[model samples]
Target: MKVLLKGTSLLLLILAGTVMGCKSPENASNFPKRPNILFAIADDQSFPHAGAYGFAEIKTPAFDKVAKDGVLFNNAFVAAPQCSPSRAAILTGKNIWQLEEAGTHASSFPKKLNVFTDMLEDAGYQLGYTGKAWGPGNWKIAGWDRNPVGPAYNEKELTTVPSTGINKRDYFGNFSHFLEKRATGKPFFFWYGGHEPHRVYEPGSGAKAGKRFKNVQLPGFLPDDSVTRNDVIDYAFEIEYFDAHLLKMLKLLEEKGELANTVVVVTADNGMPFPYAKANLQEYGTHVPLAISWPDQIKSSKKVDDLVSMIDLAPTFLEIAGIKSAPVMTGQSIVPVLFSKGGENTSKRNYVLTGRERHTHARPDNLGYPARAIRTKEYLYVKNYKPERWPVGDPVPPNDENNKRAQTEGFKTLFPGYHDIDGSPSKTFMMKHQHEESVNRLFKNAFEKRPEAQLFDIQNDPECLYDLSGNTEYSDICADLRNKLDQELTKQGDPRMFGSDIFDSYPRYSPMRNFQGFNARGQYNPAYAD
Candidate 1:
């Protein structure tokens, strides 16, 4: 065995030819010794939105193909509802709470944390990524020389695009470039991080593309109106765009004779960028679509209903590559689930936990709405540590002059205050109609303060429209879930258990917004100063 340095910081190990013997299923004589890993992650997408999930309005033939070829996971949740922290959880194989600064949104990734990609690189797998990877935050600020995911292959750009909001970067072209640059006979780990279906969609693009508002299914948390429906349709268009690239990548792999030897896992960073989702701990916010396929190892056309967390992905990848997970990683590997032939599988989780701290500069002093949740097969119990703080954000004053400026420069740029929800046509429409009798309840659900403890029977109320915490009949169920959540969070060393403000003390790296009383002095966190 030999070790070599690549570039300035990356320590690439060049193992002897004998390294080829390190395979997951050594007995499979026809399979490649070490399978290549192709991980495709969409920017902001929810579960049941893919064609494989019976969402006919959303065209996702590529995702459907993967589901048909492998396992389709019915219950997959992220550690955080926001992209940065959720992505960090996937890379580190730890829940957002288990991570310190890395746990919060738009915060620096601590250098000491070990990511599976780094471990894969050290074990002789060629590592690279294209499009969005492990950020919306600064990895370099925390002492990394490059993006935490891997090297970038985002040079290729599309000349003509379908929508203005869609990224022009040719995701498929860049993937081809990565394949061209790979070292011979080395198993590769490539991240196709598509920055699609997020927010700021081209208004009415769905209508122009021949999509009807009638076909769009509005979630119960949102208003059942044309404006909101169109917004969802536009979101679907971007999702289809993301899937198109995945199809191209799959075709390229097949042409290269690498499809059968590759492990393909497709999912999203978080849910759709919407008011009651995205940064929130609701079902759509945390639960995401997941499909995994490996011709040589995994069985085909199976649907798994077991609870799975995004953190488990890192451990699974490491196990497949014949590498061990980091000691700090708390997630259990799903390799057993993957290898299961069918019914009565060994992989089953009692519950999966999710939480969040800070999203954007939505409140004064950059304070985040702190909350933790526990989701079992039947119910979801959430405990808002600070129920006093507004869940979405402090409301923007109606008479503020910034409202006019926001119309021109956008709500996000001028900070019209409900900054947790991304600036979009749907948000604008909802705010305009918040005073109306028909839309008032939906608006309040999306943006309002809440009780500390809330419980929902997710199976019955998938929309989470009714909180069962206050109901006497469900009191026992709520109490049981709360006790379970507290015990596990305490055992896992969550700072929130000790009433620590550690998450809020982490410095934010993205563009800051000015809310009421948000001054320069309040913006700085000296504890995290360089």
Candidate 2:
């Protein structure tokens, strides 16, 4: 009886050990043995454009599928309004102001900064990017032998008319090739940057392709005309085209049996290119779509409205890959939000900040309108660092014969029926009017001087049509936001907020303005008069 009892005890102990071994702490990580990453970025896509974001005009099945299966961030914002600075922020996980040249449009990224690709490569992961990657500038000085995407990635060739050629690098095709070349067991990260939906679109590309202009929804700032509608349709056509390629990439991943383990992130660098959109610091300008998917690990689909920024992407990627982020990265990882419990509170910030240094080469001395903004749920407060400079840029007077002739002819063709048109016909019509009153107001709205501080009630004025800076009702909120922003700037060691003379001491570098030997008008005028 004693022997039998001892045997039974041993058997029970073996069973318990087996159960404990099967449910180890290692299983809690839920990380794949070797998971792949695919980060697809669009050139100029704004929020609510993708079908997943609730826009019916364009169908983005691949992006929608990811959102349906994973998580969608409804309030993700980019660090800057333009392409280069915004992309730089995503790469470095630092605000644009922290990066010197990389903060400006068409500027060369400094070699010293640590990018995510470098961190991943150091962590024993294969990294390569196809299509646009840290571009519109010379990359050699940035310590890159090739594009920052990777050394193995293929270059995409341009396809356009002789005079107006477009960069037609097949981003999807390159991504497929990158996946095929990766070792069977090694994980790889690929950046699929699509240069679509940007400006200089092919006229009637939408109509000829069966897209109806009537289906387009015009923004309140733009006129409700065929030209504007057609422009939007053309924009949608490119978006659809981008989606088609994205679908192809997803199929390739699935066929390779890497779909379940792969983490796919779909987003854009900045807002859509429009009159009051792309270059500005409005909600529509900095607000972008962000969706992520990881089927093997992520259990449910969730829509998060927490305030997130493009700067957070780097840290998140590193954390997922079991790699530590560098010390200088200002962004915090959002991994908790991704795999949070139902009742988990994972909001990192109550507000998001964005700014700009230089955009286009339209200003005197190539000086851009330096503005910083802080956006909360109900309000947006902007501080124009240089109110004396043009808000848009210095405007070239229409005194030249050709400009004058174009102005006269454009006005005549725009308003043919009215002998005396009162109250500017529309945005397009006002563009042709060269009169001082008409021109002054347009410039004031677009390029003239602005106040040092501006406030907008984004809830009511989504387009930021009215300025409530002078309103006493919002004065307290404005002051609080301003104080918060100043504290942040001080923490970041910005000289402007610290009241230092660094602004006057620093040398100005013109990347977008003079890098390509083009003048403010985008013409190849060889006069170095500036």
Candidate 3:
């Protein structure tokens, strides 16, 4: 049986040695004893960028070394493309929809939920985190005592950084700080959340670091120009910078003689912070780099191509640590896949589902762009709840005085829509060159209005430039995927399936934007007051 609770009582499980208030996983441990967990997650990074993933631009020696020592995952994905929701999934072992307020960007974390960190702590594993945890949101309002990710070791700070907007927190020093505070001779679970490679890079930082532009390769969606290549190089510089700290942490673990017993996982929260990348649920937005190294338990120098979700990491960690997961957790553990000696036997993990809502309050009335997706090995199907709404966000929001006006009556167009896209050098180039034929394609792809239903063959079109949903040749395939998605959502009791409309009604907790209402398609509607 599983432990299920609701309301304020859910947070009362501060008692030790309990597994979601259910039976302990120690009863089911047939393998060796539990291992220490050191999860290192990067902020705003995408797949095919790590050196281990064969991306030529980035140099991730630390990530590559981890892959060499353990298993490298080629197809790793997070539940949402945004930071708050993606990290919420990692903590709860559930999808975005299951998390209520936490499913949206910068919203309140629901205190009723049971996260893996809490479970591990109750099971007697010492836990703490440094750098960014589950964020861009207010965790205190939810009634919990601390951030859902864990306690903070952010007392220490550093000044030297390679670029602007990169986190200056000494992550390696914090990890060492966490080690000093733990109880003697006990298993530990430490989260090293690196705030790197998100956005706001120093101009020409890559060139400043002596990185050659020839090694940069732009994705198919972006233009093959010098600016885009240089932009990507700057991103690479951040990746390498982030990796450098992990290298030092690995050395520290080795020095402590805990390297063999530590389950080291290195990944990211979401995709790159760029237009048509981070906020959108596209291939690049959701696909992330993953490398897990545990020299004691799993095989070395291997690769696993199984479709795995970031949420699944919670259950995997819980299971390995001899703690049972909460019943609300939908993510399946990858322990079996890890111990299977690097074989393609993951028949149950055929689908990788993800979705997003309201990543930023860029639209009038704090409206969210709701979307759900189901990705199989062959194709990817998407269902947009509101096709009439701008996919990125409204071009401009209402003014401070008029922000509280009716949301859907009407408005005037200001700038081109797609404010959900992050501010970046590559985006600046596309916006500046929209008049040219070669660059307009790039702008349209990022700012265009998509249909209610979208389908893409991920194998052939990982960029998702062409929509195969309406094509007659793929009608049956589209219908099958739709049916599959609806059935799964229905089984999971998703509010969307029940016509609940809860997602839209949920209060937008992020600070509202006041940019003046735009181009007559939408109107003013303030989300919520502070």
The digit string of per-residue lDDT tens for model 2 on 11-96 reads: 44233221112111111233546467898888888887889877867889989989988999888889988888898889888787
- Residue 415 of model 1 has an lDDT of 38
Each candidate structure's TM-score, on Cα atoms with residue i matched to residue i, is 0.90, 0.81, 0.89
State the local distance difference test value for candidate 1: 0.82
What would you estimate as the lDDT of candidate 3? 0.79
User: Model 1, range 1-530, lDDT digits (tens) per residue?
Assistant: 11111231121111211011223331222333789999999999999899999887898988998888888999999999999999999998888876767888887787877888998999899998999999888788679998989999999999999999999999999999998999998899999999999877999998889889898878888888898899999999999999999999999999999998799999999999987889889898999999999977665678888888998898788777776424446676787777676554445689999999999877766788889999988999999999999898877775666555545653344435687888887788888898998878878878888899999899899878888899999989988999999988876667677556667767677776545443232234544232
- Candidate 3 lDDT over 122-200, as tens digits, reads 8889989998999988788769899998889998888787777678898888989899998998899999888888888
RMSD after CA superposition, every candidate: 7.1, 14.8, 6.0
- Compared with the true structure, the alpha-carbon lDDT of candidate 2 equals 0.68
Judging by lDDT, tell me the better candidate of 1 and 2.
1
Candidate order by lDDT, highest to lowest? 1, 3, 2
Question: How close to the true structure is residue 96 of candidate 1, measured as C-alpha lDDT?
Answer: 82
2 versus 3: better TM-score goes to:
3
